[model samples]
Target: MSKEDTSLRFRQFEADDAPVVYSFCLQLIFKQSCWQLRKKTMLNRGWMISAVTASVLLAIGLSWPVTLITSLLCTYLLIWISHTAYSYYLRHNRYQDLCSTAAFVARWCSGGQDRLFVATLEDGTVIASSGIVHQDIDTCELVRVATEESYQRKGVGRALMKYVLRQSTSFGYKTVVLKTSDVQTEAQRLYETSGFSLSKIYTVGRGIMTVYYYKLNLTDH
Candidate 1:
C-alpha cells in the first residue's frame, strides 16, 4: 500500500455496509454509462454529417451567422439525442438489475462461499470494495471491484485486490475469473497487471455494450 493509503483498513462486508456499497456501485455504473454515451455521441457519424453541411453552407457564400446558428442547432440536437438515448437505456437496461436494491446487493455477497471485502478510512467510510464468489470446485468469479473516484491511484484498489486474491487462494480456488466493460480501461489495466489474462470479449445489449472477460490462474501466482 502507498503512504496515502496507510490509514486504510480492510475487512469483510457487514450488513450495515450494504447501503453505502450499493450507492457507490450504482453511482459508478451511472458515471460509466454517461461517459460511454458521451463518447459515442461525439464519435457518431452525425457529427460528420453536420460538419459537412455547415461547410457546404459556408462554401455557398452563406453568412457566417447563418452557418454558426446551423452548427449550434445541430450540436444541440445531438446533445438532446444523446441524453434521451441514455435515459431510455437506463430505464430498460439490465444494469439496474445488478444493483436494483441494497437488499439484493447484500444477498449477492451473503452466500457461504462468497467473500466481499471493503477498504475503509478511519471513520469507516468505504473507499473501495471487491468480492469473490465460488464458480465451481476449482474456480471463483470476481465481482464488484470498485474504488471511490477520489481515492483511486492511491493503492487502495490494488491493496483490496491483493486481499481478495489472497482470500481466494486461502479458499483453495485454482482460478479466478472476472468481467469488466471495455470502457473500464483503468480496471482492465489493474486486472492485467494483477496477472489476469484476457479470456474473451463479447457484446450485450445488441452490440451496444462490450464486455471483456479475464481470468487468473491462482496456481501460477
Candidate 2:
C-alpha cells in the first residue's frame, strides 16, 4: 500500500522516454540501493576519513584520561558497527539490483511477449514500475518491481502488482514467482496479502542475508 492518497496513471514504459523514465530509474535504483546514501554519509571514503579524524581528535582533546580512552573506544566501536551494517546493506541491495535488472532485461525486454509497465502521477511523473519475464514453459517471473519511496503504501505498488498478476494469468502462465529480501518486509507482506505463498527462503552472500521466494498459482486465481 502506498502512503500517498493521490491516484496514479498507468502506462507502458518507453525506452525512448529516457529523459524522465530512465533518469528516474537510475536515481531510484541507486537511491533505494543506498548507493547515494553511502556516497554522502560516513559510509563514503572521504566522509569516513573525516569522521574518524574528528572522533579521534575529540577523544584526544578530552580533559580526563579515562573519559578520553572510553570515548575513543566507543568511537571505534560505533564506526565498526556502522561500517559493518552499511557493508551488509550495500552488499544485499547492490547484488539484488544488479541481478534483478539483468534478469528483467533478459526475460522481459528480450521477448516481445513480455510485459513492462510504469505508474505515473497526476502531474506526469513516473513513480512506480514493474516487469515480468518468462521463466519456463509454464512459469513467469516477476522482476524489477519498484515504487518511489514517497509514494509507497498508497496504491502504486499494489496497482502494478495486480496488473502484472492479471496479465500473467491472461498470458498463459501457470505460476508467477518473485524474490524478496528479508529487509523488504513490507514488500513481502504485500506479496503474501496478494495470495503469494512462501516457496523457500535461502541464504546468500554469507549467513547474514536471506532471500525469500514467493509463488502464486494463477490457475487458482
Question: What Cα-based lDDT does every candidate model obtain?
Answer: 0.78, 0.66
Candidate 2's clash total is 9
Model 2, range 191-210, lDDT digits (tens) per residue?
A: 99989999999985443347
lDDT of 1: 0.78
TM of each candidate vs. truth: 0.75, 0.63
The alpha-carbon RMSD values of the candidates against the true structure, listed in the order shown, are 4.1, 7.2
What TM-score quantifies how close candidate 2 is to the native fold?
0.63
lDDT string, candidate 1, 37-82, tens digits: 5566556544775787689889999998899788767875776676
Question: What lDDT does candidate 1 reach at residue 132?
Answer: 87
Q: Tell how far residue 67 is off in model 1, in angstroms.
A: 9.3
